[model samples]
Target: MSQPRTMKSTAKKTTAKKASTAKKTSTGKKTSTAKRTSTAKKTSTAKRTSTAKKATAKRTTASKRAAKQTMASTTGTRATRTQATRAAAVEGAAAVPLPDFLASAGTLTLGQRKLLVDQALLILDQNYVHLPLKAAMHAVNPLQRLRVMRARMERQTAETMEPEWMFHRQMSSIFHSVRDLHTNYLLPVPFAGKIAFLPFMIEKCYDGAGEEHYLITRTVTGYSAPQFGPGAEVTHWNGTPIARAVALNGAQFAGSNDAANLARGLESLTLRPLVIQSPPDEDWVNLTYIGLDGSTQELREQWKVTTNLPPMTDLDAVSETSASMGLDLDSDEKARAKKALYVRDVVELEDGQSSAELKTPAAVGGADLPTTMPGVFRAREAVTPSGTFGHLRIFTFSVQDPVAFRDEFVRLAGLLPQRGLIVDVRDNGGGHIYASEFTLQTLTPRYISPEPVQFISTSLNLRICRRHKDNPAGIDLGPWFDSLDLATETGAAYSAAKPITPEDGANDIGQTYHGPVVLITDARVYSATDIFAAGFADHEIGTILGVDDNTGAGGANVWTHGLLAALLNEPPPPDSTSPYEALPNGANMRVSIRRTLRVGQLSGTPVEDLGIRPHETHKMTQADLLEGNVDLLAKAGSLLAAMPHRSLGVTTSFSGTTLTVTLNVEGIDRVDLYLDNRPISSEDLTGAPLSIDILEVTPGQSLRADGYKAGALVASRRRTV
Candidate 1:
């Protein structure tokens, strides 16, 4: 969403009219007259010319001088034109030619065809001048095409056009390939810098007739690290001595009779040590020696100590390296412990179904009540029949469930005493669009006066060319080479487009409690809330209240790519050897798509960055809420209550999971409540030491304790454990 405030306002009506009329008049008379006069003079001169013998002599003398001048001028003009033409020709030739591969292909697979078309469309849309052919090829591949294309496009369109795009792309590609290798290759390759091949086995397939078995094998490789004791002693593994070694090597595996058998064989030979110690600790060495199986033929072989271990680094060097890797020694240790606990808890949760029951002490009073109203509350002070004034109801939308937004709205509206209403959507974050639409429909009267919304049209360009042996005829490929068509425009245009006007339906306002309505909004209102605001502004059905400021105007929709590179490349600060480390690799992008135009007299005003500006503006601060200042809400309620001949009343009750408060007034209405001059929800009243519904009481007077006890108790009160 564009910031509504920053949007350029349309020219004033008077100025627009003057400019339009002036342009039309200027183009219509003077220009037409000038063109007609020029044509007339040329025709008159041609008619006057004649040929005769006596005039031949005079004509010859004049023709000779004229011919000489004409020849000189023509020669000069020809040379200039030739140079210009050649320059244009050279530019045309220098332009990037169409890809030879695409030109040669008669037909293509679905994937190939989609790739080509998408690439072409993207190029056309972006007008990229220096896209490399190799990069384009990579973008059209089946597995990686979409991801590559999106990345490339984002980089190309970035505001800065930073030179880091190539580097990022290459790094991302390498990381992706490495991840795939890890996932696909099941063989336990040593981290000793050796590339080891492990064979994969496929087992059995089931069919209705019987089970079928198949055998297959695949190899995988990677480098592996070594483990050693603190005293530079080799750890004992099985019966053989464990030596630290690093190498770059590859291997091949033979297929087995059955996939299961092959898998078992591979598992038997593979050695995957969880803890690889550098200069192995004494305890680690002892454990390794004890775990060794002397009976095993493979382990019984003697160990060869051909090469000595490399010299260990100093403590300072190790510390420096660890810091550069972004590891925190203390935090890493804590994280490892937490990970173990987390795994244990997850396992327990998964296995112990009965353990899910955790007993919690219930509270007395209204602590556990489900009748808590979940909607924005406003405070409005109103005068009663007895001349006493207090806070009253103004407007509220009960949004308990996103899907039931419309239903809640309808219920609230029906409960209102008067048809005239004011809806406060300030601070509303977005939810479901359907709910917003439903709310809008309910507010709209049955009868609608037809009006034109706007006009929508699109133009597409088509390219047609024919090659020639010499100079081919080149047509403009840009602009509208095809056709243009008009489509339905919404709002005013819808009414304008219709020819037959039907009799208006009975006004729902009369049937219901239709009265003057106002919509209040602020910057925090977004998404579905914004949509509702837009509808209200467009219909001219109500007055808007509040400042024109929207926080979400600049960011309507966003895209996020998760942490991968940050974890693998840019590790956390204070590097350590611990495997557990915090990784923060969150990135996001946001873009605005649609443009919003307020309707009625405000049609030219945008509600994108600049929020819907209300007819009346009021700013609410945090201090107001904390201190129990109800001035803003009270003002709104007073305005609504002042509407003529309106009876004001409020009904409070428990409705399943929510507390329902129906405040009705003959005209516009407002409601506000405060506890100890501090604002609180109805739910907060249940167990509070002091709570009062200021809306139902006289100004500066608190509700009596008896009234709180008499009200229906929906649930027991909650107390801190």
Candidate 2:
């Protein structure tokens, strides 16, 4: 009863109409009452189910809220723990003590120290991005301190560490064992955008002083083939395709193998390498390769070698066939053929000519016919017996002495019909400076203006000795002046105007010849040739002729002993290493004992790119040489003949003890009044019919006019008073 009262199910009952109850006695009415009782029971059960569903919904909502809070608290705790752990790790790393070995060593070997510093710096760069400012600063402080310490140590011990000794020590360490040297030190050449490596290992040892030391050496015996990355293409000068193979083993170490032997080894490997090809216009291609010592080996191999390429066995036949079929030859083939042909032509001409005929020619048929002679001569063929001039002359300095060139020049000049010369220096290359000086003195005029001409110091060796400690005497006033006089019979103070040294004390002055000279030059003319050109120009000796337009004013300070000295001190890095390898003390010192410049004399000027130009330009053409047209040399001689005589007019006047001569001229600037054919003074005309004190004039007392306009002598006339 209590449960029924408490269960106010709140079910709304449906009421039937009272009027329908009047027929309640029927059968249908009796069934309807029974159904109503069953229906009411079902309705009560449905109401209980609805109430239970509401209660379960409330419990689910409350449980979900509590679970979310619990998860949030757990996640927060985990994050806090992770952060603290990371902080502790960082702090521990920062406080870690330096290794006792590193501290006790005081100073590391140059190579070892550099490697360590470079590795540390690389780590710092990568981690700095994520670290806080304080942490980054803390990391950098130790690295900077180490660098300073190393630098100071290097300076103090540099003198004691000979590069040769260091190299030997390094080599010993590398070959100690193969397994220990598996890790190679890779060096990057940023300029070349290439990478290289050395197989190295460290060994502990004691020095002669019984001091503990470590030696680092390379493992490889001789040389290592450069390992190229994937995506690299191999090509030759002609852009020929090449195939490549990865080395099964790293490069082998062969102690100081010559280039030829190395090439043979590479060929045996069947690596299919391509070599630089020769231009069709050249005799040979100068192939260069990395040597065992990491230096460039240029043309050191006696025979050319290329792997897996079709041999050029039938090249000559192919070229011949192509020529017959009127097909164009390849660039490389054409160059080789052209050079061979040129050499043949030059040899043929040289064999056919005689020395005397090439220099001077006898007037034939009284018509001044073209000279037809042979052999090497300084004079133009038109002025000599030969009507033609040779293209070039090469002296190796082995056969011809330096002093002899000047003596030969003087003798040849006197032999020529007229002093019209073409000094061909196109193939002269270079030799001793003394040789160049000798040649220059012979070509220069006997009389020089008192004004100081420019002098060049091409070598640092000379500059240091002359300008620095070696000679306390002024730089310009040294043995160099005496060297200049070696080619001449005249003393240092000898002059055409007045001989300062008495004739009794000095050798007889050499005969002076006034002539027209032309200097022919090309790019091959370097070093001593350059010095000769400058000296000639300064002294107004001759006109320079060539396509090269500028002189090498900047001197190449190269000494004969430069390479030798470097070897004695540095002894090129062992045959297995590069010359640029760091010393044991970590010092990256480069030796540039020898230096070169385009302009040897002028400091600011660069002549390497700008070549010296000729007064009259002529190119070396196959057609011209074949036709035997020596027009360039002919033109040079004709120019000299066209020049007017030096003497024009000379008149004498007497004023007290003074005697003077007035010279008349039309196209002349100033005249040299030579008393009795001896030059008196340049620009001597002070006044018209001017008088000069007789005491100053030479005793011969013959007045002559030596007038010049531009580069040519206008006229010459003489009178006796």
Candidate 3:
């Protein structure tokens, strides 16, 4: 089994994102990352000093796990773990009273509560780019909801005001009503950072008869749900049927559609992102299920809170969240939790030992990849029942360098089996808008048409564009300014839709993987991933296979109050015109300020709420969950088998401004050659290895070739001199 290394999460140039926050914001400038300061940094230090201090006092569940591991390492014995397991069985794995903390901590005074509400309202009303679109699409008006909540709060006395739990829930729900994850009411400190979870995960799989069954697919090591482990079918959750419970739980989340809601709702059962969620109303859940031995089992699982999470410093979290973000709010924490379960606890690398119980199935065992960044890309040859083909799992596009990111992908695709390929972006939540768009051309054989972005026409929106038109470090909203300026007279609802990802960058690395490609996506695929999927479908880049009906549909660029604050208050005295103010008690807020529109034939369509639908859909089967997407791969394989096979490879050799282009082709009747996207020459091939040499082709210019199958274009390849 190949062990794919998970990069230690950080945003530093070295820490990862923040360190190399090259997540080019609107200005296309790489961000200077935030430090994980033991001591406060001067920027927003006074505002965050108390937050840093408050966070230290709590033991997030992961921290507790780490602490126990420290003790076990000191003892260096199996007995310590054995004792810990025993303790877990008697009480619960990392279980504690969550109500006590939520009920006590993060309680804001009435005046502070109203102030927070007002500021959030101001941001949403003034700058939220999706306001008009969301108003038309969803039933709940977020602005109206907030105002209603504020009105209710105004009449309450100190003793009668709703508890902290209700306050957070109400605030979170207003954002949820919009059904856009990018727009969220992040709870204050302790609650904001902690994640609530059960030890084991329950997944829904369809049996042979097409009946749905909930099974315990994974668990924290040593801690099973009582005597039951994987393969146990859960019958009930808190007295309600498990399936129905999932539906109810999912409604509280901000999933864009029913399919997304169900997926998210199911996940909420085991892992809840407290950053965007209130603590589970109940401290513990009574679960009843049928065990593997055909015996019925019942157990009480306590919800555990863990602070062992990814660092979400206000600016860093919000900056990345907005720019590279279509980011599922809880993606960082979810990634950390998943790593703990599958990588940290189960896989032992230092000793070079294997645990067969948890070993990955060979079909899903990623091939040994030699890339510097191993976490983002997973390469494997999937031997599905239909056939064996190259499987490239793009774990994320949320990386620091789009160039390095796409270059590595091109390299990996070249190394894999060239017959057919499965490009899996299942849970990718998106990062770096440019990275996602830049990556599109690598998969298809055409000049990628990037999805365009538009701002809701608002006076504040226009002002923001004007403020940063000259600042190169941040958003240079020059392109949209003229239209926005004209909107006042025209009474336009939105600024002109334009591609944020440059067309040159989008087509820069055109069609690296020429094999008939099938992209696999789930509801978790959002933001940047959404853009990628839309582009894939719009550009006719082979088939799309979905595990759910649609993608997460989070098609907007979000800005945290922090990112907005930085933009408006740059270089010297703060801009008095800026509407942002620090929230009370380290609370934060986010809103999608730019909405994305689909391109190509689906032109002018908003990607939000209406995400890309797949060409084919597969239901999750028992084999899929237990055996590394076996069924899903089979579906992808079958699709790849039927798709047309065509290949085009461009190799360039330049001699003194004269460029020689060599084409290695199959299934192509004729080929067209282009120099820097301009048509230079053409060839009608008859069983020939065609060569096109063009004069006056300068160094550093791009050479491209397109293959035609009987007059219709079929394949393309691009290369730089």
Candidate 4:
């Protein structure tokens, strides 16, 4: 019986292979027979493809889990990804099929064209971040405007416009007109599995004279371009000058700003490899480069095929995974450590065993500074001659529990010895609003409300509650929603008439530090962080420092809705397709329902395309890129040093088995003590550290003690029992 079962399994596997091969052969996807003949190429392709898919899936799963977990606390949404997917899938089946827009888009009747426009307008009215802006941009009657757009697209195509292409063009017109960075229509992935690529990575390079050039960074496996090794300057591609090629490609993408568009162009030059219509025809391109030896060289390079480079979605998935982990796999050491841990866990799973749980071993001497760079969620302290600075780098606001995150943040902030704090939200895309709010309150000083000022509109509260009623996170947001007083419309999204009073501020925390606050930001700082930044700026609570470019203009609350599910008002079948998936390909829209505003700002103001500007601009030089942001930190420290510095005295004493810690905090108002790396006590320092008597010491047990004054570590002492 065992032998027969084994034989059947083998046969099934063989059949799958045969079927896959037959399909490929029928499609004539075999680009290079010579490469297929190579054993190494076959193995490499298989491994790479499998790895890429697994990575993409892992990332997608993690993100889904986070969304579900954070919903209750952040948005009061009880919707699970599974439920949403199923809803989309089920409704998609019954939803009125838009005219096969791709096949006969150009021939679409005026009514059919109007239907698409109407659907889009419906979404814009309900979910656009800034409806007032949208109205201003495209205020004409939906049907009339769509008719005009269709005519324009038809004129542009000069023939029967491709349905998929036309669909994107129509959406692009609306998005471009609105000019919102977060609002754009995506088309389906143009290419899928077994696609052709140039088999090399391109990077922006600068010479001593600061002239910019495109340089080949790395040559991918299974193919070699020795002539185009690293540092080889690409002067032209496929007969077009490098600069012209970049501009042509950049124009294809809609970026939030000039910097983002240029970045996309660089990416396109590297990844958007030439595609051949037929095998053995135009399968290669000529590249003219200034070789390593300073001699100009030209070579005809054949495009390489890789099953790993699946679709745009897969690439984005991998990139998202890498970003979420705060790892640049190509460089960062901590990223490599995390990758190794991931691989180890995978190995454990294959072995039918769970990975070993990490334990916090007893601290020896003092807590050792991590040798590798910290991951995205990290708290580090630096003691400078001027003062101590605590740097908190948070990548995303997504967390399992807002309360838990708040507690951890309080604990971590208490551990740092500092008169200044640097909150770095660089490259952090937004997540849970509640989690960010928690951090904000933890960092902000106590303040009393002056009358009931509206922070959010009643309409937004009602819509959010209705939409997030089934939040799987089981967080009770009723109190929060009920607390808001609905007022007139602000026109951005909601109206604010009364303020949502602060309940958790410095007064709520055990310790409060009146310190200089510096927030590090970049163009990638978006969404919830954008809210945090705007609030901080509006209140004059901190100084915003960024790399010249304003932070990302993503101040809208996003929700994924199936196009059909929303229109039909029915749950759809379970499908894991993302709302950001291209239209016409998938019936979904990544909708922004609620717009975020600064807490204390005037009404109708939103950080849309005009993101929060930095108080001081810092630019990254070539040396900074190579050596890390040491100079930036130094500058931040200098700015922090300008603020007055205060220190407190800490003393420890023991009697019998009781340990008494005294903090002579003069200027500092708060003090905390830790024993053996565990928080023992936190108290207000009123000219004295609230003396704590702990009777936990045992004979022969070594003891270590540390004290913090107003969230900064002030003293450390070790004693033997």
Question: Which is the leading candidate under lDDT?
Answer: 3
The segments of candidate 3 whose C-alpha lies over 4 angstroms from its true place after superposition are 1-104, 225-227, 311-324, 345-370, 650-662, 676-680, 691-701
Q: Write the per-residue lDDT of candidate 3 for residues 622-686, one digit (tens) a residue.
A: 77776678888998999988888887767778788788887778778888888767888888887
Candidate 3: deviation at residue 597, Å?
Answer: 0.5
Residue by residue across 1-721, what tens digits does model 4's lDDT show? 0000000111111000000000000101111111111111111001111343353344334434543443332233222422443333233222111122112223344444444555565556545546565556435343345556656655544245555444555565555445344444432333212233344555554445656667664453233333345556677877898877777665554344555455545554544321111111234567777655455667665543332111101112111111111111111111111212222222111111111011121111133222111222456775545556887676555432333445555555566665788778875655544445545644443232211222234443444434333432221223334433333333433443322212322112322344567889876566666766776676556678886468766666544334323322212332343222223433223445455545455444656556788888766543333333555666677778775444444455678877665555545666555554467666765664466677866554434434345575533333444
Report the backbone clash tally of model 4.
25
Ranking by lDDT: 3, 4, 2, 1
- Model 1 Cα displacement at 192 (Å)? 35
Tell me the TM-score of model 4.
0.54
Q: Scored by Cα lDDT, where does model 1 land?
A: 0.26
Score each candidate by Cα lDDT: 0.26, 0.30, 0.69, 0.43
| Superposition error at 248 for model 1 (Å) | 53
Going through the candidates in order, what is the number of backbone clashes in each? Answer: 70, 53, 17, 25
- Model 2 per-residue lDDT tens digits across residues 1-721: 0000111112222111111101111000000000111111111011111243343343334334433542354345444534543443233222111121112222444555455434433322221111122233223243354456446546644455444323322322232111111111111211011101111111222223543222221121222222111111122211121111111111231111122122222222211111111101221222222222223223311111111101111111111111011000111121122111212221122221111122233322232222322222223244323333222232211111232334455555555543355666653334333345445544443332211121122222222223322222211123333333332453332111211111211111222334456677653344345545654555566677763343322112112111212222232232342122232332221111111222223432322223344565554332122223244455555545554322234557675546766565444566776665566577744324433344455344666555566755544444555
Q: Per-residue CA lDDT of candidate 1, range 567-677, in tens?
A: 222322422432222211111111111123444565544443344445666554322222232444554555555543333243444334333444333322222433333
Query: Candidate 2 or 4, higher TM-score?
Result: 4
Per-model TM-score on C-alpha atoms: 0.28, 0.33, 0.82, 0.54
| TM-score order of candidates, top first | 3, 4, 2, 1
Model 3 poorest 10 in a row by lDDT: 14-23
Off by over 4 Å in 1: 1-403, 416-422, 441-518, 547-594, 603-606, 621-623, 627-629, 645-721
